[model samples]
Target: MKSHRNLVVAATAAALAAGLLVGTAGTGNASSDRVDSAPSSIKTVSSGWSIPWGLSWLPDGSALITERDSFKVFKLTQSGTKTQVGTVPNVVTTSGEGGLLGIAVSPNWNTDHYVYLMHTASEGNRIARMTFDGSSLSGYTTLVSGIKKNKYHNGGRLKFGPDGYLYATAGDAQTSDLAQDKNALNGKILRMTTDGKPAPGNPFGTLVYSYGHRNPQGLTWDSAGRLWEAELGNSTYDELNLIEPGKNYGWPTCEGSCSTSGMTNPKRQWSTGEASPSGVTYADGALYMAALKGERLWRIPVDGTSAGTPKAYYVSEYGRQRTVETVPGKNTLWLSTTNADNNGGEPDGADKVFQVELK
Candidate 1:
């Protein structure tokens, strides 16, 4: 993003300490100012870049943002300054939905000095660990691997739960029938330890936390710790599902919802044209979803487990939204547009990141 290409040089120590302090990306300074509201205004924080896919905050309030094709990560400050922290190794693009995907800073970062990344590798999609000493990245080690990969359907979003376990999304990898195979890792939500082993209390005693997914690209937890997933459908619909451990979500059996007895229906479903959704976040008692093909942002209010009607914002104003993240400690959001590659057909370096003001 052009706004991200900094003119003012930054100190290494101060720049590296930008984000992280547990419980979320925001800090205590603005903790009391926290409000849950829908985005009312938007500002361009960074401009003119490739597909900026993943975003994570550092402990000191600065954030780390990733580009899909470049396989690079930039550290962005709240005031609009950015610095290149370092590039990840062993990342390969599928020329479709692969490359550097999701990133998460350890909740125990102060003592661990660890950061995690999910990316497309030579063999398949893998989750890897690297040491980020507050400045640069080093020491790459594969924590989880052997996930089947395809040009599309490579679900790659990562987050840490309140229970201190890592959770990830794995798509069906174009093998739709395999989504029903609990013996496989593809098409499931995986819960694991930092070392890549299956977390304790997982369903089926495997990494699979929940199964029967197609191309689930988005995940977020609500106030009650309920996991919400956004999945891309085959032809008819996309889904917003409230995930439960060991529950069967009908994939090949049904696209949106069906009368299948053992299948769990979604909380909400959208037409594929309206929502090729990705990167969901909880804000203001609602879920702010980034729509890729819909080219808009969706604000769906939530009361307990009930999802209210969704209101569309900035419809067609920003083209092809990819990621929307809460700017910790505030009732605002940071959204990115991916108008550069894949179906967008725009020039390679024509993307942007925005700061959305919430009510």
Candidate 2:
């Protein structure tokens, strides 16, 4: 089994170098212009980079962006100055979507100064924590390992929930059955302590928070503390689900809306051709979703318990939007591009990090 997995990873890396595939990567400013009402007012803050991925704010008023292909993390200042922080640990870069992926800061960052990451480690994709000692990384620990691995479906989104616990999304690794297995860690939203242990009051005794997810690339919380996830469907019916503790998302069994007796239904579903939702962020009392295949930014208005209709901007505008993150203390969002994926468009510089102003 180890040998087979190694061969698969090797092939994936080779394909990546050959430019046969691209990975997820985006961000920008918060604007007063209603993005849904005036789509044309969406402005770019910055751009020009190799593929970029997850994003997070730093203590020095800067931001960190992940470049999956190069296995590097960049610190970007307010003026758009970019500096290489350091390469993430134990990432075996591969094609069609595998590399150093999601990144997040400790919720209590002032005391811990730890940065958490979800990457494709040797034993498979895993979640780990590392403390940033101002200049470099130290005190590394593997919080969780032994996740399923494959070319695609390696879900790696991470965020700190309002409840002071860490929430992460994991793909099924192309093994559809794993999504429904309560004991398995794949295809689920996992909640853990800052030390990587399962938090108390978890629906399951283990790390499983919610199950039956297809490929959840994004997770965010509304002002009401409601959890929302952006998931990628197999061939159709992408979803925005109201995530509940221990609830099933009806993955391989159900695509768009929920029909299963025990699973939760999606609040909104879009065709694959419209939105391959990746990163999700809530700012100014709204949720912003970054699209890859749909090549647009979706501004979905949210009330306490319900979400309004999705208002899309930039349909085929920037090519392939990957991640959307809110830069705190500012009214802007950072958006990235993924034009190197198996389905991404050609052109050497198509992969870039961009800033979009929100209204």
Candidate 3:
């Protein structure tokens, strides 16, 4: 049976009417030198969708997102309208936890208009690239194939790092033991070229950048070019790890704490009850994590490569937060929801996109 542990107990009609809600996380001491500013404002953009996953902003201030179970990619404009851009192919939609997942534009997208996607395919899970004209997609190409898939452990987050290469997250397909196998792509962070070949200068000499991940779903970099990932643990801990090439992260072996030697420890971790960190991003010297099971937005300050205490926002605020992306010009965070899941509360058209302003 799938875990149904993170649902909210009650709901407010006003909060639902306003199209907003919140999640919660534990607090800790400040490890980073800089402190996070208080949250200034939180505003909802839209809701009434199924499981909304990946998010990417367009140049025109519009945004594109994948509706997992629906197998469609939506374009959301500044004025708060949603239009179906294209149907994502090969998505094997599963209730609550799986379907069309992550989306990202080409690093050179202005010229190529290429967008990439990670989804659970008919055979299993796969990554593909597609091109989008102003109105719709023109072509599609598979980038990676033959990945195993299951309902709950599909780690399908994709991002292009500052270096212009794509980094992908893969889950162990519920086989926890696969996380420790360096030769396998499952349960690992992979660095690859746009064509899906192992990236140059990778420490492992294989597609694996780091191994021993449970279900990594978040990837982002700071202004200083450090890579961070958010991972979901089985039933114990959820983690935020600072990634290093070729290092092991002790999944299935260690859930929280730096318990294993020769493995990189998480900069921060929370119990499964506290956080099921999904998507993460760095902006204004802090890392923002979107929690699914935990249902809150967490801001962790970063000093160099280390993390500080985390501040929670929207705890029981919304229902279940899915992804958080940073908006460049405004210096605010854009948060999206995951209300269609079984454990999620008030399942009627409640998923939303929210803008959080840092004071």
Candidate 4:
């Protein structure tokens, strides 16, 4: 088995060196607009997490993390000690990808104490809000529901935008036709208030901010206040999209790039094998994306709305990365591994959180 693994690595390295593995290495162009180096070091912050799926930092410098299958949430201190915060109510795991997912603390957490969560319920995927008193969670309220959920493709990423509104990503749930439906919440990025109503400036006066997404798991904003997403493709090309209100992203009609009218093309794309891009966070001038099947972190330099060529780092070194978040007011990033889950198939104690120093 060791010999076979070595041979596979050697073959993959040869393919990468020969330019056969697309987007697996840095594009050799030396320019100021592109990422020229990878992260300098990766230090494990914590271990023994069971498929840590969500990470959100609190004002007190602590982080709240969620376990996908266990439906439990933990409060992790900056020094790496984890204490069980509590389990989310009514979360159910269907396939491996479902169950407790993305989490975000409210921007006014000091006053309201609200924390948002996206999870798989028995009926479908839903978003809920809870109150946290810095130790325990309570006051659960279901904000949104009826998002289609299948055994696969249940998109569950939650975030609070810079505009102080909640933003969510919903998958097509394997129903390709729903991606094109503007009225449906599936396969769309939704912008809403804390009460789950549509935001005031939402396109179409509905919660649907943008439509035609396959399974977007990442959402972040650049320093310029432009929204960006990393979406998983259907067997062809994954995308890094510049999201605009009321614009169509061309998921079912076009996988990567097309000339279709009323469709927006991705700023950058990668073959599906090289980039099942998941969580994304923007820091400095680059958008860092966490890859699952690609098993790496991609640094895509962003200038205004355009993205330069991507550079890969930690390829196959940390197993499957599920989330990447920029530490607030710091040059470090917090990353979570999903190797203990069914997809990665690594041994027990395989899941971990790492603090990476950006170069």
Candidate 5:
């Protein structure tokens, strides 16, 4: 049976009574965290939706959220209102982990009118640009191409870093060796210009910023502007790596952390059953990770380059958490689920997005 969602427990949630209460999303129970964490008050902001893969907030505080299989982009306002802005065209799914995957509003969206999307097309996975005049999508242009894609590992998360460059996670595409290949694009953290060219001062003088990754789907920066990544491992462990330029993460050779000579190890690691991590965001001196197979949200404390022990929340309470991003200028997080993932068996519109307040 499905438990009820959207009951607010504190006065903090009442501040959202303006428009966040307009839709079916409701403020839920105010419960203490499992352990040494803050009181987390959660409420559903949007429901009856599909797999909302990529979430990027705009300058106006509204957000553009992408659906994985639908190839549609929806505009979500602060008042909990959802609208279909436009559909990203020419998107094809691999029936596993491909489609209109990641979306990022250009840092200068107001001036450039450009919205970037990383999707699977007929050829392979590509990063493309489309003109979104705040209403519809037009003028499709391919920015970066030649990244391989497969049924399982597409590594499709995009974020504009503090340095103003676009960073993307490219999976190994079921081919492990390609991760260690310096010339190939797959299984690497790519830093590129807004124009889709290799960013200036790259380690390999190419788009590849770091290599030897498996299927990294999450990217975020701390207050210090240091990059941290979440990677899904093969059979043993999932990794939360402190990403560095031109470093090896040891994918096929090391699942989580190993004694490899030149390979960098994850700051913290988890068994696969404990954390099949996807999207992660930073807030309140911690990294919030959304787990798909593990079905939980992990809050890991960060002290510079070191990661403290992880504390979990909503374990098995939600089906599958997919994307977690910080609400800009707020002490809250927006968490999206992926219950409609993988197989064609699960019906669409079974997913929901929640507003988690770290009180």
Candidate 6:
């Protein structure tokens, strides 16, 4: 049987809704000589998810969450109620990191009511669309496929940009040479319309926007419409990059920042252990990154294309943060923990969703 645990007791949900679980200390590392601002509150919205990989807010203020291992999708209410909507069909869950991963609500959801999903299948990783009826999902339509997949390194993060185009991240799937191949769809950030066709104004005639990425999982656009990405490095360093159209981010040739010609360097880089950053969100003039291996949340201020020193927060308090999204029309964020994954080594009921007030 599929393990679905909803452990939100009435008392716990009431306490969290009343803001009784707020924290006011900077338990993690602060930036160089700069004091960290305390978050107004941090409360557990719900718990007992199994490796929740994707989170997307609906127009009605409810949220949709995807479980990576279970191939299940859930609808979470603000008052701490979780209902299993349905599971995506034909998802091939692998050992390391492959399954139903990222989800993005359609930009015209009020009319179209379509939701997009990225998942690992029998042939490779693919993107598909489904009709969401506000309670359950139906009508799975494969939009794009055949990117390549492996036990690890299937970059699966999807988002609808402000321009109403869908942007997706694709890893090299252990094929390092593919990052340098412009013709290959692997190791690229692809931009497409809702119908999965290449978006107009693309630098290439194809769907490839920026190429030469190893395993980029986080993507967000800044106030200036500049795209930012968080990438996992091989063994040396992880990177926070500013993406440009038709640009190439050096992968096999350069792990982090390099002096190689015709390759774009990262805006900031950190050692592998310190920052295996995943889903990122841009809000209130900063980019918030969820760290998996570092077990913390990083706040990096952005001024145009430049980035300042990064500060850590809630380190080890929430084991292995996976997704961080800024709540619409509010100064709060929705954060999801990934402690149920193998890398976290935590028991069942370790995964949770949190509501955090930004300072």
Q: Which one wins on TM-score?
A: 4
The residue pairs in collision within model 6 are none
| Ten-residue stretch with the least lDDT total in model 3 | 21-30
TM-score of 2: 0.86
Write candidate 2's Cα lDDT for 14-53 as tens digits: 6535644322111112233233432335544456666777
CA lDDT, candidate 5, residue 225: 98
Q: Provide C-alpha RMSD values for all models, in order.
A: 10.1, 9.6, 5.0, 2.8, 8.3, 7.4
lDDT of 6 at 98: 92
Cα shift from native, residue 103, model 4 (Å)? 0.4
- Write model 1 residue lDDT over 1-359, tens digit each, in one string: 22311331233223324521111111012213223576778998978778988888888877888888898888888898877778999999997999999998898888998889999999999999998888888899999999999999999998888889999999998999879999998999999999999999998998999999999989888878888888888888788888989998899898887778999888777787778888899986888889887666887776676666666676566678988888888888999988897677678878888999988
- Best candidate according to lDDT: 4
Off by over 4 Å in 3: 1-36
**Cα deviation of 97, candidate 6, in Å:** 0.8
lDDT per residue (tens digit) for residues 269-352 in model 4: 888878898899998888899998888788888777668767677767677888999988888899998987777877656799
lDDT of 6 at 94: 66
Candidate closer to the true structure by lDDT (higher is better), 1 or 3: 1
The better candidate by lDDT, 1 or 6, is 6
Candidate 2 segments whose C-alpha is farther than 4 A from its true place: 1-40, 347-349
lDDT of 6 by residue, 99-189 (tens): 9999999978899999999999999999999999888899999999988999888999999998999999999999999988988889999
- TM-score for each prediction? 0.89, 0.86, 0.90, 0.93, 0.89, 0.89
lDDT of candidate 4?
Answer: 0.86
Error of 5 at 219 (Å): 0.1
Tell me which of candidates 3 and 4 scores higher on TM-score.
Answer: 4
**Any runs in candidate 6 off by more than 4 Å, and if so which?**
1-38
Cα deviation of 96, candidate 4, in Å: 3.1
Which 10-residue window of candidate 5 scores lowest in summed lDDT? 21-30
Better of 3 and 5 by lDDT: 5
